[model samples]
Target: MGLFDRKIPFKYLLMGIIFLIVIVLVLTGIWMSYVNSSDNLRENAYRLRTMTESYIENSFQLIDAGLKLYDTAYNHDMQEAFAVVMAEYNGTGGDPSRMDLEALKTAIGGMDVYVINESCVIEYSTVPADRGLDFAVIYPDFCIYLHEIRNTSGFYPDRVVRDWSTGTLTKYSYMPTSDHHYILELGLQSEYFEGERKQPSYSVIVDEARAFNPYLEEVLLFQKQKRLIGNKTYVPTPEDHAMLDYILWENRTSQEVRDTGQERTVFWEVIDLRDPDYAADMSIFAKLTYNDALLSQELARLGVLHAFAGLLLLFFGALVVIMVSRELSRPIEQLVNDVNSVASGDLDHAIRPVSGYEFSSLAESIQVMVDRLKEQIRKCEINEKRFMDLVQFLPQGVFEADAEGNITYANRAAFDLFGYTQEDLERGMNILEALAPEDHTRAKETFMAVLQGKKTEGSEYSGVKKDGSTFPIIIYNTARMVKDGTITGS
Candidate 1:
C-alpha cells in the first residue's frame, strides 16, 4: 500500500492526527499574529504622527503669533530707522559713503543696516563686507522679492530664514524711501534679536521631541529650518532634498518606509502658514520617525509561545492515545489466546472472560464448539466398547489395521488365529510381519486389492505363528473411513 493508504496502528495514527492538528493551529495562530503586528505598526505610525504633529503645529502657531507681535514692533522700528538714515543721507548730501552707518548700527541695538541702489547692488553697510555686493547676481530671487516690497509704502516682514553663507537664522524687514532712490534693509540676526523673539524656537522644540517618546527616533521641522544647530551646520543628504521637494510640490501629507539595517517609518506633513505680511513662501513641513525592532521581537516571542503550546497539546494527546490503545488491546489478546487453545486439541480448556461485549460473545461461541466436540468423543468411546465385545466372541478372526500395515485393534479370536497373546498384540506388530517371508509380497498385494475394493475372497497367503510355525491363511479385510472421507485402516 502507498504510505498514505497503509493501515497504521491505532496508537500512532491517533498521535499523528493530534500532532497535525496542533501544528496547523500553531502556524495559523502565528500567521495571524504577524498580520496583526503589521497593523500595529501602521497604528503606531498614525499615533506617533498624531502626537508629534500637534507639537509641530502648535510650535508654528506660536511662531505665527510671535511673528505678528514681533512684526508690529520690528516694522515700526525699521520704518523709523529708514527715516533716520534718510535724514543722515540728505544731511550728507545723499553721499552714503559719508554717512555714519556704524553710529546708526549702535543707535539701533547693533543691527547691520544696508543701502541697496536701484540697480540692486549693496552700496553701503555697517559691516564692511556688505559694500559693493551685487544682489541681482548673488540673490536674484531675494532681490526680486525685495524690489516688490520696495513698491509698497508700508513696512513688510519676512519669516525666520537661514543665512546661506554663515548658516545663521536671520529675519529681515524692508521699507521704501519716499524718493525711491534706494531700498533700505537691516539685519544682523543670529544673536542680534535673541531677547526679542519667542522662547523655545523651532529647532529647540524639534530637538527636544525625542526626549519624551521611546519609539520616536528622530524629528525635523522643515518650515524655514535651521541647518545650523548652535554653531554647527547640518549638511542634508540628497534624499532629504528630494523629500523636501516632494512635500513642497505635492503640498500634501505622505509617508515612506525605509530599512537601513534597522527599519523605520517616516511620516511627512505640510502646513500652510503664508500671510500677506510675509515676503517669502511660508509653507511648513514636519517629519516624524519611528522604529520597528520592538514590534518584530514581540511577534517572534508570541510565535515561540504558540509553538510551545502546540507541543504541550501533542504531548498530552500522545498520553491519551497510549492509554486508549492499551485498554483496547487487552480484550483482543485474550480472544487470540483462547483460539490458540482450541487449535491445540484442548477441548477441556475453558475460554476465559474478557472485557467488552464483543469479546465476551466470541469467547462464549468458542466454548460452545469445544463442548460439542467433547460430546462426540464420549459417544465414540461407547460405540468402540460395543464393537470390541461383539468382535471378541466372533468365530472369524477380526482385526483392524492402519494404511501403514500396523495392527491397531484385535479381538481374542484374531489373536488365537495368529497364535499370539494379547500381551504380544499390545506390542507393535504389522499385519505383513505375521506372514511367512515368501508370502509377504502376495499378502501386501492382496491388502492393496482389498483397499481398492477388489474381491479377494480366495486370495491365500502362508502365515507364521508366534512359535515360528507356518500355516496357510486367507485374508479378509475392508477399507475403513472416517466422517471426513479419510481412510483410517482395513
Candidate 2:
C-alpha cells in the first residue's frame, strides 16, 4: 500500500525491461565485433591491392627502360661502326695489340660499353682479359644472329643471351659485321636496374638463367644467386639455401610472371601485405595492422564497459528489491503482532497504522471492537453484584424456577430455610423434590395453580432439608410475568 506497494510492482517491471535491454546490448556487441573483424580484413585486402599495383607499375617501367636501352644500342649507325672495327681486327688475323684494344675500347666506351668484340670475338673490354674471348663459344645464338646479319644485311635489335664470366648480370647488345663481327655486351649489374627502391617481399627479378630453370628452384636459389653475384664469387651457404627452399615451393602457384627474357621470367606475387609475419616492416601493412589492433582494443574496452554497466545495474536492482520488499511486508507484520497481543489477553494493546490507508482503517476497526467488548464485561459484573445484594434483603425463603420446573436461583434465606446453598438449587432439585411426601402433591397443585396465573393464598406446605430435618410453613405463591404478559418465573 503506500508508494512502496504501488511502485514495487513497477520495479519488477523495470527489471524485466533492463534484462531485455542487456540482451539487446549483448547482441549488438556481437554484431559490432563481427563488423569490425570484417572491416579489418577488407582494409588488409585494400592495402595488399595497392602495394601489388604499385609493384606491377614499377616493374613495367623498369622493363620498358631496359628494352629501350637495348634498342638504342642496336641502332643502324652503331652497327655500321661496330662492323668496321670488327673487319679491321679480323683482317689483322685476330691478334689485337694493347694499343688496338685501347682504341676499340674507346670506341665502345662512347656507348658506356663494358665489352667490345671484333669478328664476333671479344677483342677489347673495360676489363682487360675480356679481350680475345670467343663470343661464339660463349653465346651461340648471338653468334648465329651475327652470321645471319653478315649474309642478309639485317639489323638485329632483340635481347640476346651472353655468358656472365665476369660474375655479373650483363646487358648484351650486338652489331653484326661481314669480316669480323663486333659484339658489344654491356655488363649492367643488377644493382643498376634495381634503382633506389628495395624489392618487396615475394617479388623477384629473373633474367635468362632464372627463366630457363624452374621458378621454384630459382626462388629457392635466389639468396645463393644474390650472394654469388654480390661477392663476384661462389661461396656455398647450405643453411641459407635450405631456409629459402620451403617458401620457394609455396610461391610456385601464387606468383605471376611479369616479363620473360630469353632465359628467365621475372615472377612476383601479390600476397596479403598486412600479414604481420611476412609484411611487418612495410609501412602500409604496419598501418593496417595498427588499425586491426585498435579495433581489437576497442572491442575489449567495450566489453569491459558493458560488464561494468551490467554489474552496476544488477547491484541497483538488488538494492531496490530489498527496500521494496521490506516496505510491502511492514503492514502484514504489524497485523500479526496485534493479533498475538489480543490472544494473550492484552486487549489494551492497539495496532499502530503505517502508510497504507487499508492498514489505518483496520487498526481503527480493531480498537472499536475491543472497546465494545470491555463495556459488555463491565455491565455483566454490575448485574451479578446487584443480584447478590438483593438476596441478602429477602426474609422469606425464595427460590426462582424456570417454566420447566427446574430451580434457577435461590436466595440466602431460601438456602438457610432448606439447609442448602444456591449450588444445591441447580437442575437436580425442584420445590416439589424439597417438599415432604405428604405435601408434595399439594405443593405441585398450588405451584401449577400459581403458574397458571391464579394466586395461591395461605397454602400450607411441609418441606425437608438435605440434613433430613422437616418443617411446616404457610406459603403464598404467585406467578411472575414480563411486561408483555408472558410468565417469566414462579
Candidate 3:
C-alpha cells in the first residue's frame, strides 16, 4: 500500500476537539469577568457621587442658617433701642461702673451682643473684658463700621463681618448707632444653630467683611491646615490625591466660577438648616474624602491580586494544554511513523504499543496484518521457485499461455526446442509468429480447442526462432491455470 493510505487514530482527533473546547471556555470566562468588573466600577462611582452630593448640601444649609440668624438680630428697631441707651449713658457723663456694666451684659447676653464706640473701642461685652480685649484690633473692619455710624445719622448698614477664631468661622451682624456714635456687633457661637452638636472639621462663613477681605489670617497665613490646634495645611499624599480625585470626579457637580474669581460651586444639596421652609444642609466633604481614599486603596489591592491570579491561571492553562497535547499526540505520531515505515516496504518492523488502551489495540491489529502479509509473501516465493523447476523439465518447446494464447512462461528446453532465445519469449512473441506459415493454421486450431476446455492429443507444429530458424515440434496440450485458478493455455 502507498504511504497516502495511512489512517489517523480517533483518539488524536478527539483530544484536539477537547483542547479547543477548553480554550473557548477559558476565553469566555475571562470576557465575562471583565464585563462584570466594568459594571462594578460604574456602580461604585455612582454611589460615591450620591454620597458626596448629600454631604455638600448639608454643609451649605449650616452656613445659610448662620446668615439668617445674623439678619434677625440686626433689625432697625433693635439698632434704634441700642442707640438710645448708649446716648443716655454718655449724656449723663456717667462712669460705666462694674454694676452698670453687669446690667448691660445681662441685657445683651441673650442676644450674644458686643458694643464698640466711635473711637473703635470695645466698651462692653457679655463675656469678660479680657476675653475680648483685642476684639476690635483682631477685626479692624468692625472699627470701620463704628466710623460709618459716627458720620451718618439714623443710618443702618446691611453689612456683616466674619471672625476666624480657633479654626472656626464666626459670623457677626453690625448695626450703626449715629445718635450714640457707636456700632453694635452681634456675634453667634458656632454651636448655636445645631445646639451643641458635634461640629464639622471646617466651617466657612460668607459675610460682607469676608466678601471685601476674603483673605483671613487663619486661611491665608497658615500654609498648613492643622487639626484645629495649630496652623497647618493638610497636604495630601499621592495616594490621598488619587482617592480624593476619584470621589470628587464621581460625586461633585461641575465647576462654577463666580464674579470674585473664586470657584465656589455647590457640590451637593440638602435641607437648608437656616430656612424653616427647607431641610438642613451640611457638607461632609472631609468624610467623603476619607471614604474615597479607602476605596482607592482597596481597588489597588484588588487590581494587583487580580493581575497575579490571571497570570497564574494563564500559566496553569498553558501547561495543561501543552501536557495534554503531548501526552495524546505522542502515541498517534508513533503510529503514523510505523505505518509509513510499513508502507515503505519495511514489513519486518514491529509496531510497539504505548500506555493507552486504544493505542495497544491499534498496535495489535497492525502486527496481525504484518504477520499475514509476510506469510503470503513467503508462499508466493515458494510457488514461483516450484514453477521454475517444473518449467526446466519441459520438452517439445513447452510453454505456458493465457486464455488469449499469449505465452506466459517459456523454459530453456522450450526455447531450444523451438530454436528461440530468452529475448524472443520475454518480448511476448505471438504464438502464431513462433510457428512456420504452414503450421500456423494448425497451431491456431489446437489453441482454440484448448481454450474451449477440450483435451488435445499429441499434435505436430513448426516453431520459429529470433534468428528466423524454424523447427518441427510435438505438443501434448492441456488446460492450465494461475495459482488462483484462472485458466491459462499451454
Can you write out model 3's per-residue Cα lDDT over 361-384, one digit (the tens) per residue?
998899899999999999989998
Model 1 TM-score, all chains together: 0.61
Off by over 4 Å in 3: 1-23, 57-271, 277-323, 380-408, 421-462, 471-490
Per-residue error for 341 in candidate 3, Å, reads: 2.6
All models, RMSD in angstroms = 6.8, 16.3, 13.3
Error of 1 at 29 (Å): 5.7
Q: Which model is ahead, 1 or 3, in terms of lDDT?
A: 1
Of the two candidates 2 and 3, the one with more favorable TM-score, higher being better, is: 3
Return the TM-score for each candidate structure.
0.61, 0.35, 0.45
lDDT of 1 by residue, 396-458 (tens): 888888888889887888788878987787788999878888887887887787777566676
Question: Model 2: number of clashes?
Answer: 7
Lowest summed lDDT across 10 adjacent residues in model 1 is found at 224-233
In TM-score terms, which candidate is top? 1
Clashes (backbone N, CA, C under 3 Å), per candidate, total 0, 7, 18
Taken over the whole model, the C-alpha lDDT of each candidate is 0.70, 0.53, 0.55
